[model samples]
Target: MLLDELVVTADAVASTRSRLAKVDALAELLRRLEPDEIAPAIGFLVGKPRQGRVGVGWRSVGAAMGQPADAATVTVAELDAMLDRLAATSGAGSAGGRSHELRELTARATEREQGFIARVLLGEMRTGALEGVLTDAIARAADRPGPVVRRAATLSGDLGETARLALTATEAELEAVGLVVGRPVLPMLAATASSAAAALETTGEASVEYKLDGARIQAHRVGDDVRIFTRNLADVTHRLPEVVEVVRGLPVHDVILDGETLSLDEDGVPRPFQETMSRFGADAARATLLHPWFFDVLHVDGRDLLDEPLATRLAELERIAAAYRIPGEVTTDPEVAERVSREALAAGQEGVVVKAIGSTYAAGRRGSSWIKVKPVHTYDLVVLACEWGSGRRTGWLSNLHLGALDPTGEFGEPGGYVMVGKTFKGLTDALLKWQTEYFPQIEQRRTENTVWVEPTTVVEIAIDGVQASTRYPGGIALRFARVKRYRDDKRPEEADTIQTLRGLLRM
Candidate 1:
């Protein structure tokens, strides 16, 4: 298929606000693709190249721009081949070689195709439809159930390949894509709640496990050969030999374990999340090592337990990895759940995860079967500025630059605010419209991308906690911060102080 056809379809997809419309358009586009073009076409439609993150930064794309072709000449297969070559080029003369190849690829296309190729390479194809929407489109095009395709994609860890199969293979073939012992399946996620009692109310007689402030890991073991994958499915088997050794010591021959790993202090207390993350992604040079805590087992000895209930899986997990299991108790009482949560907090852990005892694992999506309960700190902070939105939030001011009041002019003037971080989360379309209409009235200045506003608007923000950082003048930033609401009743002087946020760091 012509590259222009795909570009036009993407532009149309981005132009609409309705998800159903986007799915229909993408489904129609999918039906037009040949069997060989399915993967690359789906990749382009979802704003990514088949060759993922091919080391092509904005500098390389910016340097390769030239006169556009007068006509549409590039095909989806040809573009995929070009990207394959670009991804394979590395070391020594790789830079010059990549530049020449990129220029040749770009020079073959017209202005529209060049822009689309740049967007795809840069990973900025901002059509509202990402993996979720495209998965739905694939299912609709293939005449298969959405859940079937979603589950297959989640287990396979490759949506492009899943899409190819869904379009070409039978439903039985798609169902046969089960959990392989070596490949990493998408880890199940949890929804957040304010307290354990509320979480337990959602899932009665639940198993509440200690939620550790650590990196998520999914370990796949086939006898002595063990592979560890991070949350995003990046293999880090070579980074932590101790982790591999621990998995090798397990009694089971083949198992897929879902768990967390964190470094501990001398007192055996869990370290801060920042410290854990730093070492988690760092080179293997540190003396401190991370300890694994298993919570769920997805597979055991060639038996796939993903379709099994949580209670069944937990029994198997306790039977196989009892020594490394996370500490918790199964309970139906809300008070017991609350007590477990308090105990987890008192032990320097993050909180507790309340899970439905009978619920099976929903791998890809953040289903409501599992709830994460943690203490939240809310404070009235000032809005420093706002930035233009994109995708569905196109014309509205979406991202808010949040700041805490510096009472003594330590960072700014007396009673001024210092920026902590930016967040576009927890904003609805109605709120976007309100910000677009109201924020400009307090406008201090305007940039091409942002609208600076006076530090008079007080907004209530809920945060997981504070982390020590050098990026902000207050020496800390809010973690997992989201807008609770706009505090119209409060003044800038009455807002929470930077000292209050910094104090949270000590806690």
Candidate 2:
């Protein structure tokens, strides 16, 4: 299929606020793709190239832009091949090779196709066709049940492969996709609650486990081999050998453990989040060893526990990895929940995650089955833009323009971020220097004082609370907002929503 067809469909999807209309438009486009073209086309529509992050930057893409072709002639397969070449370009003189290839690819694309390609390369496609909507569209195009497709996608952790199976393979083949011991499945997520008591109300008879200030990890072990993946599914087995040894010591021959890993001080108190993250991102294991604490066991000895209730899974976790299990207790009482929350905080932990005992694991979905409560009001927000610093902080990107996701277009465009407020507080000199150097690399456009960027950076912000405001499109402004930290473990789409902030008006 021609690339223009996909681009036009994406344009239509972005132009409409009605989610049904967007899904229909995407489904129509998906129906026309050849079997081999489905994955690459899906990647383009979602702004992530199947090749992953090619070494191309915004400046590199801009330098390659030239006169566009008058007509659309580029095929989906051809574009995929070009991206493959771009991803493979790396070495001493790879920069020139990448530039030449990008120019050649852009020369064959029309103006519309060129713009779309640039956005895809820059990871800036804001076309409202989020994964949920596209998953529904794939189901519609394949004439498959939505739940079946969703299950397969979640299990495999690859929507492109799921689309191929749904469209080209038989129903039985698609249904056969299950949790593999080695492959990383999407981690179960938690919604926010004001307090442990409030969270208990949402999840009755819950396991209120300690919420750690650490990196999320999913460890898969088969025999003696172990692979660790981050929240984004990036493999980091080599960076955390201590964690691997800890998982290898488990009695089970094969297991999948969901948990957190963090470096602790001599007293066993968790270190600062940044220090833990620094060790987590290292190229090799550092002297500061990270300890793994398993909270839920998804698989054990060939038994799939994902379909099991939390009570059952916790039983399995206790049986196999009790020594490493995070501290918590099962309780339904509000006072007990509050006490657990207090204990966790006193231990220097983040807070508590109250999980419903009877609820099965819902991978990748933030249902009310699990709710997290922190002492302070903190949220993961997106960095929409950054302003140049002044006075003592001159030349640095000091003030961050924060935004919340508006998934339903209640406050603005669907799948777009609504600016809620700005903050220059809580940043250290080191952070300011890093921001000054990093923000320009991802710049989409810039005014004299502000540099607009792709809404991809997630930062955790703490606030006193939110108050109704007319200055922002979301009709809410953060009160005394300050940066907690930059959430490198999260994605832009995973940021808290505008509706969530608006709901705070009630508090």
Candidate 3:
């Protein structure tokens, strides 16, 4: 199919806010794709290239711009092959070579096609439909059940391949996709709850396990061979030799274990999350050892437990790898769940995960079956500036640079503020318009993409919490920060301090 066809479909998908409309548009596109075009079409629609991050950045694409062609001529297969060649370009002078190839490719595309290719390369499709929407769209196109498509896609961990199968293969073939011993399946996820008691009330008899603030790992072992994958399914077997060694020590001959891994100090106490990440991101030469804490077993021996209930899976986990299991209890009593949560928090862990006992593993999706209870912190913060938006948010100020009032002139002027992080969440179209209009009235300066304003607009911000960081001048950063609303009743002088935000590090 013509690349322009996919571009127009992506535009149609982005132009709607209705989920049904997006799914319908995507399903229509999927139905039109030829069998050979299915995988590349899926990737382009999701704003990714078949080759994956082909060393092309904004600067490379921006520099490659040229006059557009008058007609749609490039095929999706042609573009995918071009990207494969670009991804393979390397060695000295490869940058120039890649740029030449990109310019040649961009020269062949129309202006609209050029924009679409840029968006795909920059990872800014901004379409309402992501993998979740596409999953539903695949089901619609295939006339299969949504849960079946979701399960197959999640277990396979590749929506491109899932789309291919949904378009070409029979339902029985799709259902045959199951957990492999040495191939990583997407790890199951959890939804957040306000409190442990509330979560237990939702799940009734639940398994309240300690939720560690560490990197997620999915270990797949077959006999003496082991492979470890991150939540995104990227293999990191070399960086996690210690984790592989631990899994090798387990009694199981073949297994798939989902768990968390973190660096610990000499006392066996978990280190700060940032410290754990620093070690986790390093190569195998790092001295700090990462310890694994197993929580769920998806496959053990010759048995596949993904379709099994959580209670049965936990029993299998206990029988095979009890010593590696995270500390927790199983009960219907809320008070007992609360005690376990408190003990976990007191022991310097993040929080507790309350899981439904009878729910089957819903891999790669956050559902009600598992709920995580973590403390939330709210603060009145200042908006220092705002960046121009894109796609649906075009012509509006979207990303807000957030700051905390720094009373002591240690980082800046005596009363000046220090930036903690930036956020574009929780903004409706009306809010975006208001910010675009109001922020310029207090403008301090301007850049091509951002408008700097006086740090006087106080807004209430909610965050999972704060953590130690070297990125900001305040030595801390907010985790999952989102604006609740503008605090018109409060002034900048009354905004929360950096010191106050830093106190959350202790918790």
* TM-score winner: 3
TM-score for each candidate, following the candidate numbering: 0.92, 0.76, 0.95
Q: In model 3, which range of ten residues has the least summed lDDT? A: 44-53
**Worst-scoring 10-residue span by lDDT in model 2:** 389-398
lDDT of 1 by residue, 59-139 (tens): 999999899999998998888998899899989999898889889989999998998899889988887778888999999
Q: Identify the leading candidate in terms of lDDT.
A: 2
Off by over 4 Å in 1: 15-17, 45-50, 65-73, 107-119
lDDT of 1 at 5: 88
In candidate 3, which residue ranges exceed 4 Å CA deviation? 67-71
Quickly count the clashes in candidate 2: 0
Candidate 2 local lDDT, residue 145 = 96
Q: Which pairs in model 3 have colliding backbones?
A: none
Tens-digit per-residue lDDT, 289-383, candidate 2: 89999899899998999999999999999999899999999998999999999999888788999999999988877789999998678999999
Query: Deviation in angstroms for 39 in model 3?
Result: 0.9
TM-score of 3: 0.95
RMSD after CA superposition, every candidate: 2.4, 12.1, 1.9
2 or 3, greater by lDDT: 2
